[model samples]
Target chain A: MADRVLVAKLGLDGHDRGIKVVARTLRDAGYEVIYTGLFQTPESTVTAAIQEDVDAIGLSMLSGAHLALVPAVMEEQRRAGVSIPVIVGGIIPEDDIPALTKAGVSAVLGPGASAEEVIGAVRGAIDRARREAGGSAPEGEPGGSAPQGEPA
Target chain B: MTRREEWQKAFEKAPLRDADFETMSGLPLEPVYGPADDEDAEYPGVYPYTRGPYASMYRSKLWTMRMFAGFGTATDTNWRFKELLAHGGSGLSTAFDMPTLLGVDSDDPRALGEVGRCGVAVDTLADVEDLYAGIDLEKVTTSMTINSPAAVILAMYVANAEANGAKRANLGGTLQNDILKEYQAQKEFVFPPRPSMRLVADTIEWCAAEMPRWHPVSISGYHIREAGSTAAQELAFTLANGFAYVESALQRGLAVDDFAPRLSFFFNAHIDFFEEIAKYRAARRIWARWMKERYHASSPRSMQMRFHTQTAGVSLTAQQPEVNIVRTAIEALAGVLGGTQSLHTNSMDEALALPTAKAARIALRTQQVIAYESGVANVADPLGGSWFVESLTDEMERLAEETFSYLDDLGHGSMLEGVLQGIEEGWFQNEVADAAYRFDRALNSGRRVFVGANAFTEGNDEDPIEVLKITDEDERRQVKRLAEVRSRRDGDAVERSLASLAAAAADPEVNLMPPLLDAVRTYATLGEIMDRLARVFGRHVEQPSI
Candidate 1:
């Protein structure tokens, strides 16, 4: 089954050309991508992500609201008791990447990351999360492709 | 044999990248062009103004080096503005942060962690005062890039200027009070289209009477191009909006010449060098001809299409970040050759975050090099007579005219009505989305070559440039500042001002500027004023364009 990923744009930032591009790239890679269009709140994003039962959530923000908005998505996912890996991409500064990653973002993809890089991170992050959650995965080895539904 | 036949034969032998030879917008290109395909082009500063807006063009003086700079707190951006002025930047263009752009206060929950992130945050007149600290409003011209709540910001600016003893008639600057384009491209709108247009008309009408030196509205195509529109679409849509604004003002009983001279334009100088130049030339021609022939404007200034150009933000890549310096230089050159009245070159590091001081300096230096070194500015429209350029200009004008006719038909002979209907029907948004989708497909398919992106992906192991980051501490500071301002100001006065502003808003006959100024003076937050007006005008909830 194809891995399902939810892409969302949070906050009042309307610059979505890059996010849309990333969504198309991910969908073209055979991932079942669901895009939450512009002006999404963190609550709405997490709700859609968990309801869709996607393997990973890719949040894109360029209005410099990532620090304030990304953690809300992380917190909401935690509150909702969903363990889907969350990855972020946008015009994020290098200094902020570490903080976001430490805050439980699975991967931080900055500008100029290639399509191959994005797909690889989405797969690796979900696999790592599935293993960390004590789901099916071999110890000390990269997991196989993610399932369409929740990992066993 | 003719040049066309020879070029065709040479093309047949040499082959090409693909079977299609066309511009990015699908404008078919000929193998060669010559004088035989010439249109009835006109001279510079003339009726049609095909060559340039000014007869002397850059020979008299170079286009103003107005760099768009703002980020973090108002005081932080104030420092940047001073730094830019110290570096010989002639004019200032301000960029407001997301919360401010959306007509929200810093403390508003919707603002959250976005304060002072993308641009400068301003919640009251105090912030505006801090933004222009120590800068003489009368001496240097300023252009602000704000929509939706543009009037609120402009009022704060005016109140600040008056406090500083700058007379309204003597102040020179531009307010990007263009709301139609907000619905068409940028999507930063607060109220629906009709009320937004009314606010825009208020600003235009006010500027025509009070601030003679100020440009009230700068009809913009920059955001449209940034949103992935074609060059022709940018020209067509921007001018269409411009015509609509003129008609709206005329409906308000203002003469065409009274407000048209105070009107200006903003366009994007994308990476396509010749195409951008031709686009500018065609833009001036179309605007001038329309103003004189269709609108019956007698004055030259009313007919002229003066514009400011910014290097395309969409053209800047995040991969080879420094390579963006070269891209900006080329785009700046295009703007200069195309006869822009002013220009802002985008920072090379914008794709990463708000530009650092070093990156912004380099971007400004890129323009300085073009102005002082490139010699391209030595002549007025140096490519004016080139057959290839002339042909492209004609083609762009032709395509733009077709769009105009389509819009006219859509509006049932009213450009304003057509624009409103188009926004409602999601026509403009869909057009831009379709263009963007095509560009993405081409990039993925390797049909388009963006260096360091899809092609030439090796040997790019350079260290990343340091980027500017707005921390949570900044948001906290802004919210605290807003809190203090709220406590100190007379809450009753704010309520009274907002109440009267809402009262004026309910009546379509009253111009909202005076009451708006009163509200802003009473220290009503932008969100407060917009919210009150929204009660009357209603908020714009865009229908999804799938």
Candidate 2:
């Protein structure tokens, strides 16, 4: 089973060069990546993440609206009962990273992040989410088969 | 063996180690350049223009130092404009905020937090007035960098200029109404390619008849390069787009000579010094030849390629930010040696945020230094006879012709159809993406190096550079201003004007500028006019291809 990751761009900023590189790197690392192309809203991103059942989601925003857009996605994901971790990346200033993390972002990758660093972050984030999801499941459940690996 | 042959043999045996020995476009480089390697070259201001568009080049008049600037509110930008002019900035290049570029008013909910963050915010004709207040529109040439809503913005400019008692014929400036590049690279397109192209044609036709000194469309490859493309791809794709616009105007019954002279170009001055120079030279030769042979234009003005070059923003590094100053200086020199008519040097801090005033001043000074101090501008095409530059220029021209032929075939012997087909099939975007991916992969693998970014470790130095920050309060002010304008304007006039625009849009033969100007004069917001047009011409849905 391949680890499925969903990548998305939020808001009016159309800078996808960084996001596309990240997506390609993740895909090359054997993840089934679903990319939500530019100009996606928070609602559309959350809907796609839930529908795809992605193991993890990555959001990239270069426009300064990340503080507003990211929390909206976090809220939508929470309402949809999805615990999938979402990583954010772009030209985020250092001061805003902690705020994004506090708003439920798993990790924040800024400019100049190497491919290896991005892959390591995404893989580690998914592994941590899977472990926590596995530990919280009821014992002896039919669907409780080791869900560590991606169902896709 | 002869002494030269022996020297060549020794050089081959002990070649430079661990070096790629190729240009960024994958063209192989030789050990040395000499007269024997020089290609046949034409003189400057000649038919082909392989050397340059003008015979004297910068000796007659220096290239205009047109810096792209805008941020915060319109009044804020207006102040910047006045300061730039006072500081010897030759021309104005306007940059709009995301909402205005995306055809949304500053007050829209989707525009929250993004308004005035990237560039200036202009919601209605009132904002445009404030933007150009006290500046003589007739004297100072302005270049507006808006695409999706370019018609609305241009209409606003024309209306504002008229209101200020400036004759349309006396106005001089360029409208970067290039919708093709928006679909291909900038990704700020509102309508589909077909109708968006029609709107561009309408502007060109209107300008050809009304505004004698105005450049209706600046076919741009700057965004395509900024989006990540090779120098060759930038040359090829941008010229293909120019050809597409020419065809669109021709289809509208305008003669080739009528608008081609006013047709300008915008290109990115990437850090590759020799390559960027060759790209510009090759661009002139290719455009001149095509305009004469293929398009059958007899006018020499129509054949010459005049362009504005901006130092590549993508090449700037956030790590060791000040190193970008040197990069911009080199790129500006390349643009001058390549015979650009106008140039903009990017601020070092752009990768982090909109440039602070200090950084922007440094950028303008970089251009001024090149213009005044750099003796390289004394000669027209100083590298005209250089074996290496001439060969590269020839190779680039040949490669661009190949791309042109491919697009022509796709368009069924029409560059217009080829561009339309390319946009619909995502061919242009895919090509740029592939080049970008290759560059990124090479950079990541250490096959290529970007001085401060990929190499030359700074060890995470804590150098605190002041970045220009646009606060949420700016957005609030912009929205309030927009609301005030809406409250004051006559609702009935706005309604009638919008209906007229929608009607004009529905008819294929109707030129949209008149009704568009009418609507803008009624204080109809950018989004209102754009929304009405979108109601008639459906919004574009990008065919996602990663």
Best by lDDT: 2
**Candidate 2 chain A: minimum summed lDDT over ten consecutive residues — where?**
A138-147
Looking at model 1, how many pairs of residues clash? 0
Model 2 lDDT tens row, B411-474: 9999999988998898998898888889889989988898866788665476758888778888
Per residue, candidate 2 scores C-alpha lDDT tens digits across A22-117 of 888888889889998888888888788766767788988787888888999989777766677889988787778888989988898877777888
Which run of 10 residues does model 2 chain B get worst, by summed lDDT? B32-41
Candidate 2 residue pairs in clash (backbone atoms < 3 Å): B411-B418
Q: Which stretches of candidate 1 lie over 4 Å from their true place?
A: A1-4, A26-33, A123-152, B1-41
lDDT of 1 by residue, A1-152 (tens): 77788888789987766677777788878888888777889888877876677788998878878888898888976777666788998877777888898889999887667677888999899778877877585433223223233322
Model 1: lDDT to the true structure: 0.84
**Chain B only: TM-score of model 2:** 0.92
Residue A34's lDDT within candidate 1 is 89
TM-score of each: 0.90, 0.92
Q: Go through the candidates in order and give each one's C-alpha lDDT.
A: 0.84, 0.86
